[model samples]
Target: MRGIQLSFNKTQKLRLDKALEQLEYFSSKLNSNAIVTVSDTIPVNHEDGVLKGHGTMELEGEVVATLCGVVERVNKLVYVRPFRARYKPEIGDIIVGRVIEVAPKRWRLEINFSQDAVLMLSSMNLPDGIQRRRTAVDELNMRTIFEEYDVICAEVRGFQHDGCLHLQARSQKYGKLERGQLLTISPYLVKRQKQHFHHIDQYGIDLILGCNGFIWVGEHVEVKDDMIEDQTNKSEQQNNKLSGLASHQNQEHNYTPLELRQYICRAANAVRVLSTLGFMITVDKIMDAVEMSTSKNLNIHEMLGAEFYVLVAEREAERRSSSSKKR
Candidate 1:
């Protein structure tokens, strides 16, 4: 399912092949001939009046797939869901993106979509956490909020009239992400859910699963309204010539502890390994992989080893087989 460009030893290769073969065997038994690729004509009843949905196109009165995916039918509607595709934004979906450009009043983000998404200055909460009209001065200082290459977390606010995507960060939880690692994975692997932000208090890490396949693994930061209060207080003190009393406190925590950084790396590597194996990336799945490595007493780097890869594959095969039996 995934094409990894790493070399494997003889035993590791055999084990990996066996695990993959088992997974394929189970998949074949379940889906049979239902799966189809692009240009494939999906068989349907003409008398029933089938409605061709996404990933399908009419080709000479035939329902041909425009994408490489499995055919799905719902009453009179039929569509194909592509296996490997770019992230398609949906309203209310939380996503992680990087600012590529600071425009006139918005920041353009690269969210693994066909077109970059726009995060308007007005849509997000200001640094002071105050709600007011965005003045011309605020627009001029937009870069101070989000400069180029700043990783941001926001919610999809639907498309504009011109088909451009718009993002919003109205809440405290949605804004600039810091002290973490950003990972890219296939959007298909990330299943949509009501909750995307997960704070693992035990490990002291926060995991944000962006619907756009951009994952943020980092240290937890509390959402506070005090930033704007400090700004307000500092200005008043400056006007009264009491600047010493309004000294700016170093509130930003920059250094990540060595242990916490190691845990982040382990979790990130676990995600990478699962994605490389084409496994569904859920919180439990990722945590299980991390725990597996810990139980085996493997170092953080060893999680990416050939032997570990085969082991993970074998575990996935067993998991799938067990799930199939349960079904």
Candidate 2:
């Protein structure tokens, strides 16, 4: 939906017009003062020398917007946040990335940041959840852990003095993500929330809303500490060793169920449509979108059609207008 041109027919054109009109109407009724387009002058009392932030420029003794976005004022500082913006990594932010390189003591990952972030071997706990000094043996088996192009989830552990961003995955929740799809959206659309990891019990899907805009829609897996798991499975492992049944397991055990895969796609499509609509992406909104699709009996690809887009827009418009009235 991004960059690719979509040609709409006459009916679609009319539907989009109606939906957009409602969106604008509700949006204006809520708040319209802080919105500005490119080159629009931002009115500010320059008496105390106000500090202008990103997306603003000084021109002819006036503060002008350099981009189309919403203006945010905090005390004396003001900045505009564009609808489509690059991911800006911050310390402690959860991020999903793809491994690009496996260096001697670290793995370089493309995290949608200004540059690739480094995930040092020492920074992450071993699969056994044991803490010890990493050795040359560990370095040799780095690929056994994560190889190039593998998707991983981690947290920003601050940047080094050299300005390189570093990441860490010390918890059971953060690690390699698999059995799902990864969708990229505008970072500005994703708001940092207290709980980013979500398990949709209804669909058996795990949704990781990474702060870096790399969204993960995958099959849900139970979160458990490896330390506790290994201790509990010690007896099971011994029994399997004696029975010699480990190598005789079914090869199809790794295959994901068809229904679960469809749920993952549904969730991923919800994220895509929200990003295209420039709506604030949230877990609740995503769930609602998926539910709407299900209620309408729409196919996976139909969610991206013009009819669904209009429906989504109308729903969002109504929701916003009602919230505004409440305020």
Counting clashing residue pairs in each candidate, in order, gives: 1, 0
**Clashes in candidate 2: how many?**
0
Task: Give me the candidate number with maximum TM-score.
Answer: 1
Provide the TM-score for each candidate, comma-separated. Answer: 0.86, 0.85
- Provide the global lDDT of candidate 1 against the true structure: 0.88
Best candidate, lDDT-wise?
1
> Local distance difference test, per candidate?
0.88, 0.86
Give the C-alpha miss distance for residue 33 in model 1, angstroms: 6.2
Q: Which stretches of candidate 1 lie over 4 Å from their true place?
A: 1-3, 38-48, 57-66, 224-249
